[model samples]
Target: MKYTTMEQLLLTELVGAQVINHGGIKVCLRRSENIPSMGGATFDHVALFVLDGTVVEWIDHLNPWDIKSITSLKGSETNLYGSRGAYGTVLIETK
Candidate 1:
């Protein structure tokens, strides 16, 4: 559960963000935006969960707001997510 310096740097970008590091994994509290089709609705601050290690949905129904959480991924990290990660990704643990 150890994050590399690079990871730490990424997390730092999200100033004023609440980051919970659990075994290398990083989860930040982020605010969710409204989905146009959903009638411009908004939800409470959601969790942007980042999975640990070298890698990285209902997510479709959710309209993600500005990624005010951790910093956006770059280079290889971005490649891991493809177009979906074009902006950034939040790893969530289901189960």
Candidate 2:
């Protein structure tokens, strides 16, 4: 999974974050705000997983304090099942 410069730009602008290339993907570590449903009422750091050219999920539920993981699949078919992006997908979890 390779993250393009354009994709990195989009991510930084969308989330005000920086990218770390790791495990064939761009990882973003961000600190977010309160989330009631997750038993989180304060700011906390979360991991953003991103796979370049892959599909991402759980976009709607992404918050400031959420940790996200993104990955891209090479030579793979698009699931298009529950993802939110055309290029790739993300997994959001509490830190």
Candidate 3:
């Protein structure tokens, strides 16, 4: 399947995340309800990476062939990330 950016994100990471699909698709990562709020600044971080695994980087532009593998976690798998998992987490290995 030709994955959209949102689709790739969902596949590569962020399980248990709440997704809203209107026109394209919008992912509002579900943070813990009891953790208070960050006033919409939560998950607003995106760093571009071509290797070394990644977190919410711009993978949309990358050809699917460029991705070697994908693995993720939720509810206490490395917190999700090996170091800092989200409500869910996935690491995309680049080729």
Across 39-68, the per-residue lDDT of candidate 3 in tens digits comes to: 333233221232354455344455665666
TM-score of each: 0.27, 0.23, 0.42
lDDT of 1 by residue, 1-95 (tens): 33344335345654544333333433333333431223223333323335433233222221123222334443356566666454445553322
C-alpha lDDT score of every prediction, in listed order: 0.38, 0.36, 0.45
- lDDT against true structure, model 3: 0.45
TM-score of 3: 0.42
lDDT of 2 at 89: 32
Clashing pairs in 1: 1-23, 1-24, 49-91
Which wins on TM-score, candidate 1 or candidate 3? 3
Each candidate: RMSD to true structure? 12.2, 13.3, 6.7
In model 2, state the lDDT of residue 4. Answer: 40
Candidate 3's displacement at residue 45, Å, is 13
What global local distance difference test value does model 1 have? 0.38
lDDT at position 73, candidate 2: 26
Tens digit of per-residue lDDT, candidate 2, span 1-95? 33344345336544644343322324233333432223213222223334333335224333443333433321123255233233333443334
How high a TM-score does candidate 2 get? 0.23
Alpha-carbon shift of residue 52 in model 3 (angstroms):
2.8
